[model samples]
Target chain A: MSPRRGTRRLRLSDPHRRVRFGLAVVLTVLTIIGGRLVQLQGLDGMKYAAAAEELRLTRLDLPAARGQILDRDGNALAYSVEARAIFADPGMIVAPGRTALALAPLLATSADALMGELTADGRFVYLARGLDPAGAQAIMDLQLAGIGELVEQRREYPAEWTAAQVVGFVGQDDTGLAGIEDQYDDVLTGTPGQLVYEQGRFGLPIPAATHSLEEAVPGSDVQLTLDQDLQFTLEQALAVANENAGVSSAQAVVLDVATGQVLAMGGSPGYNAADPGGVRGDQLANPTVSHVIEPGSVNKMITFAGALEEGLITPETELTVPDNIAVSDIVINDAWGHAPIHFTATGILGKSSNVGTVMLAQQLGNARLEEYLRRFGLGTATGIELPAESNGILLPHEEWSGSQAGTIPFGQGVSMTVLQMASMFQAVANDGVLVPPRIVDQVIGPDGTVIDQPGSEPRRVLEPDTSADLRYMLESVTNEGGTAPLARIDGYRVAGKTGTAQRPNPECRCYAGGGYWATFAGFAPADDPRYVIAISVEQPGGSGGGGVIAAPVFTSIMSFALGDNGVAPTGTPSPEFRLTTDED
Target chain B: MSALPAYDRPQRVAGRRTEPTRVSLQRPVAAPAPAGRAPFVALILFVIGAGLIALLVLNTAIAADSFTERSLSQQIEQLRLQEQELQQEIGAAQAPAALARAAVEQGMVPAGPPGFLIVHPDGTTQVVGEAKPATRPPPPARRN
Candidate 1:
């Protein structure tokens, strides 16, 4: 090549152009990087940071323990225990069959079901809930690839069937499904908490990292007025009575007469709270407060109360009573046929004379009879702390037919629950003050604060003088000539009424072939009553009377109640009654 | 080293008095002559090295403590579970049915209506309820 000498320099490599080229390329890359940084850090900084945080954060739910349902004496009827819910990630599993085989024993789930769950699931599947934490730990020790556990709570019923109808049962999610559990669900379920923190790979919290927690507040406990011992006895007696009477079902309730608190309330064939799956739907309810039946001669007490309260009759007042009386297309007869006789007001009740009771009702009339019924808290809810209560069937006095007026006085046409019957006796037992039965004593907070729950306000239904006269008259029912001699506890001044009402047949809409509701309600040491117990058994297609079937059950339970509570029997003897005003 | 410092002090005075002589810190003897800050530098480096070692030890201890805390909490959880299990067993055993079954297994008979004996402060005794001898066994045996 020829060289130009005078041009100052020959172009060997063009160093200036090369330097410009390198600068242009470097500037282009720098501009792109700067723009991207601006986009990320300045333009959408909050959104991108939040997204990254979301990917790095893990949230755990801390479940606060549900409250315990304790009996009046501080024994747990139902409580919550720590447990775990086992789950699996199907995608992470190596072999579904092998995993199922390894987990079946620990989970107590069939391998076929586990295999189905593992093979047919998407990403996540719950294998079992409410597994004991120790068992869950054992499963985790197996180191199955996809299995994990979560915190949960399981309901434990220590008393089991003893207070099942009163305490109720909890379902899969630990929600109360029946009884007190259902009634006090809100008070039993506590607040849940959340823990959110930054997590590293494998979802473990980084040490000393920032985290936030909202403390969980536990639920308040419900202290029931149920005496565990008395309740157990009540249920046992009902079952025995049911077996003896060959009845369909039976119910009984014991109440503290002074405080209107339910010491025990239950029924036969009670479903065990621990295993509610095998129980029938019909037996799950607290039938003592819910089921309504004609009270028969027990309603005669109200009739007697009406007559005595209105000054129409005294305990010794004599009247001419016949064997049967016709009233509006029906003839009502006494339990036994007899000629006309002179009878006292006490005689009518002690004898459970249907004709004599009708005679008393005729004197008081329907309006006054209805007044006494309403005052006794019949035909309405007893307001006990139970669900599905009935305000028993009662037509108004104005709506009563002539036959109804005759039958209602003896508790045939009118219907009431065993609880209502007890409250009637309770009114007499509590010196004429009616205290609506209460099943809850207090609500205890988690932090040891006690909130006292006052029961329904007491109302005076009858005069104290009338109640005294009524108690004296009822004392004769357990006497020699009276109906319920079996109900008498030795050395105790027992008083009660017997009921043998004919159940209305659904097929025929009449009392025929429907059997009877044998019921006996009473209170012991009748002078100053402390407790009132109402016992009833439904004998379908049976002929037993209340004094025979229900009185035995009553005696056993009442004996226990009186003895268990250390109630002293009066040393005085029961007074004599002039059942018939006869000239010997 | 003491004689060297004395000899360098004279040179330092001569340097100030005659003309500005360039000082070289690489010369160890001359470095301490004018600045006298070598101990301060050594002290700072010593502090930094000691701090680094202290941090390492502290970190290791904290890591160990965290591990201990984890294991202890796990043990406490296990103990709590064991206590719960025992309590559950006791509760189940305390149930009326279980107690009745156990009593039956021991050949115990159900007492008839319980009777009370009152011992007055004066030492007089009187029975309240009618104390009857148990004529029948427990309900289960009777049923059989």
Candidate 2:
């Protein structure tokens, strides 16, 4: 047989092998296709879908306004107003030097300064921070290419320095920096809104087809316990005190006796919270709470209150006061040299007798006396919710020396914040209860609902009958021959105390030469106390004390506050007192 | 058990092969009546399965979209609140009352009755609070 014929016959005979080869190829192709289908449908499908959705959608946030600060009468003490500021897109400016030159005159800036700002590498640069409408408009009218006003917000102060320190100010970025602005920042800042839009292929939003949009939630408004008219009156009185006494610093605080609410707080030479550049160094400190000094004769009021509270003395109690008395190896003297003068308990307070005060303190003893001072809210911070309140110095009873013993009775050894004085005086005026001072009247939410309401919560500091008796004795402080005669109001029964404490010499451990702090604390309409005012003047020209400086200021503030609050005059004459020979 | 053959007739084995002794293993004489019941059951099953799958896919898509939208809305609201607060602060910082207060603090008292003069177009000026107006002559011009 031929070789070619034999091979052809062999090939034709293996038909089963050919069919198996064809079936194997078909199976391989099907496996590859199935694997790819699984990868697309099961393994990576969600990841791809999310990427596609992200490429088509974009969201942006919008911000809300800060809260408003208003007075009790709903007058805007501090509120927001819109203003324009010119900002430059540095990338867009064609000629930085030329643009700076054109803007310098319009912005009231030097050309060099403008050039420095223009040459900054930032995309957005502030050419001017606070520009008026006319100035902004003028700059815009110049048609300077690349320089334009950015629609950014600026804070506006409607009342400026009227309630400067209380309202506080915001920084250039509109963040609160001090005062109440710093304090309720969270409540004052509102919720931002969202704008969702469809995005194009290159990740830019499609102009017209923005989908879902949400509005911003605005901030709540804050209402204060202060009255604008009463605040103005208090400021005027402080100004008068500063002028008359030539004092470097002075402060006055007025509060409602029944409710611990602060009505007016004023300091001389205050700054505009909106424009902080005009602040002075010495005047920056709030003297009413930040500075501490010896209280002098004002301490006698505390001593008298303690004695009366303990039933140690009454209006008819007779005490024979000499010019000087030696106790605990320390000599105490009256303000005027005189013979053994017979004086009632009422007379002793009226004359502000140093010997009389010591006799009372000695009768009460150390433990009882210290307890009363503590109860009266002395030598400690009043916790009035304002920052930087000084805790005045009070030596522990274990550390009290013989000299401090006699001196403390007439307000020499201890010191207290003006708020503490006002609070303690409120106890006498309020018939026995001492309420914590409140500066915030109410917190209103964005929807005009009151979120937090403040009211007086009184704690009994003295017995009711004792408070009345003390009020009767305090009446003498505003009458003729009293140390605080200037504190009298024509138609009201005012109760007050005067102080002239010598500046303590830390080096010598004794009072220094000619430096004194004058102070007066009082309340009006003794029958039904309405207002309590305390004023302090540092280093007046004369031997400054409550009588010569602080008393007059207190009188003015009290009179104005009473009138503003619609408190009618009592028209009752000052209680008269006569020395009695009989001892109680 | 080889065939006993047709020799043993049906009358002898009546109990065992009652109807037909050997049924032919060939095509049936005629096709039995065609049944329509199976097709109806298959149709009902397909419809129910398709509806359930469609419902699951729709629910998943809606849930994903709603979750994304809610988060985006919350973020936008937060930003809007921040912007409003900033705007209010800016306004308060530049209030008219603040400007007036600043002026007063700088010792620039307001011009009022008894001191400053108000000039009118008739070449006449009046003192504050005064009833009569005074006439003034024009000043000599200055050369640049």
Candidate 3:
């Protein structure tokens, strides 16, 4: 081989330089890739990490239930039950028409309406709310796309009409509308919860993925002082009285004399708490605390009580009471025509003589009379847990007209609720100590902690001896010759007063040619009173009087209450009462 | 030259010899044996590969169990819903109206005025009011 040929071969076979060039190119590309990797993994890592987490994580809201209303005996008056609400993902629905047709029968809706809901331009829409589990399951069994059921709580009232007025009702959104339900809505509503979890495809929670949950807190329950059985009895009695007397409406209330705890309170024409939309607005008002009427002869008790308390007269104080007496410009007369005769104070009250009452009220002037009425809790709301209580009409003594004093003395010008009337009697029956009425007994928390409700403090209205004297005088009213003879119980000594007030004509605002309000207020076992009952009938047809129409209602309710409470009759005979004086 | 010097001259043969052979008297060196570490390294690599394969299989089993747990959780939710439904039914059955209806169907009537049996402090009893019968005789005890 020649030296020139060998040199040419050496030039071609020198491979180290080519290898060095290829390695340089590879290192450059790898350096660029490593730099990019460092930037992505270190500099903006948190941003990318958040983005990735968002893709796999989901959040959900959990709803809590409203509390329940229970009677004193733990019977459920109003409660919440688990229910299902059906919703649709309109965006995910494939065939709106077909889905609507499949769901219409189960949802109890028109197919066209359902289609309209399903075709709306939204991600979610409510097809139906508060469906029974069975109904919801029937729809779920179809397995239609975009259809789902959400667990919800529905308010239910088990005792439909027993204490409907007091329990009130809830709106479609579970918000209380009236009565105790509205008063304690906040305490009755519970706290909601939240859920944070990882979601897989189809939005289902991924197994073994990150998950967290916050449990819901349930609401507290309220227990009222009312007895369901007694409430039912009172409602039934009022209903019967309303029907038998042909009255437009009637109301009754019973109270424990010692504690002032209302046992039963109801009014006729009550609305069902389950369905309250059909009831009239006026009827929705609880007549026992919301409606007011002139108390008529019942006001005589206050006048007599005041007189006895002030030492104005004794039980045997003789008075020459005429059949008619003039006060200011108004002439007050007895209900029946009678001659002027002399009688004792007990006889005057037992007969419920308006003339005699006016004479005694004159001795205790308007100032003292008004003061006594105020003390009896008239002209003010009862402050019950129920909503929309009325403060009855009582003008100041300075606002009285010439005849107002005369009419006010006999319960003609003043008006008060039935609860106030019962309260007045409760004061007398409890020996002149007036206790504010209580309707709620306790509140039970979700954790089973009991919170006792504070009862109202007792206020002294009259002396004990004066109350005793008044009780003795009032007992004569239910005797044989008294006005409320029908109010007598067979084995118990009854004390009560009868009232007949002519309702003011709506057009003329006068007491002429208008309907009448008949009322009876009393207690049982006059010596040892346990319960105070008051009944009132409005606008009774024909010639019905309080002694005839309202007295029997009082008797039936009082008897039942006494018997149910295990109160034994005194079994002692009542003292004799004098109907007439020696000069008669 | 003098008849090609017969002893020193090369002989003609069928195949050609490229080089002349030489012989040495010293001991022959042995050819290099394969490295001893190579087989050991190969065996370790095989075992590591098998362990990795087993790990992958176990992970797959765990993933399958996760699916079963999800299915069981779904079943538990369904059972809870069924229990709520049953509770609602029981509540409805015990409602006042339903109970009243059932009572009427069972030949029961509403109670009359209640009477009390008063127990005195001395433990003696006295009946206050008339005690009314609760239910009428069962059709005069139908003759067998």
Q: Which candidate number has the best DockQ?
A: 1
lDDT of 2 at A306: 88
Over A1-584, each residue of candidate 1 has an lDDT whose tens digit, in order, gives: 23565333444257897788789999999999999999999999989989988888888888998999999998889998999898999999999899999988877779998888898758898998888888888998999998888899999998888989989998989888889899889988999998898886755566677688987788889999999888887887887877764598889989899998899988887888998887788888888888998888988999999999999999999988999999999999999989988988898899889999999899999999999999999888988777788998888999999899999999988988889988899999998999999999999999989987766989999999999999999999999789999999877899999999999888898878888999889998899898899988898877788999989899888888887888767667789888998753
Best by TM-score: 1
Which segments of model 1 are wrong by more than 4 Å?
Answer: A1-28, A47-56, A198-205, B1-35, B117-127, B141-144
Please give the distance, in angstroms, between residue A375's alpha carbon in candidate 3 and its true position after superposition. Answer: 0.9
Give lDDT tens digits, candidate 3, residues B1-144: 343243233332211232223213332333333478457656777888789999889877777777787899889978877886776667667655566567667988665445668789999998776656656322211101
How many clashes show up per model?
A: 0, 45, 0
Worst 10 residues of 1 chain A by lDDT: A1-10
lDDT of 3 at A126: 87
**Each model's TM-score, in the order given?**
0.90, 0.71, 0.82
**Per-residue lDDT of B139 in model 1:** 64
What lDDT tens digits, residue by residue, belong to model 2 across residues A208-228?
Answer: 454788987878888888887
Q: What stretches of model 3 exceed 4 Å from their correct place?
A: A1-48, A89-94, A119-124, A202-208, A540-543, A582-584, B1-116, B119-125, B132-144
Best-fitting candidate, measured by lDDT?
1
Better of 1 and 2 by lDDT: 1
lDDT of 3 by residue, A1-584 (tens): 69989987776577886678679889999999988888888887888998898889997777777888988888888888778899999999999999999999888889999988999998899899888877898999999999999888888886777788898888878888888789888878889888889887766667668899998888899999898878877876777777764588889899999999899898897888878887887787678998999988988999999889889998889888889988888788899888787878998999988898888989999899999999989998777777878889999999998788988877888999999999999999999999988898888898989987767888999899999999999999999689999998867899989998888878777767578888999998899999999888897343577899899999878877887777877767899888668634
DockQ of each: 0.36, 0.07, 0.13
TM-score of 2: 0.71
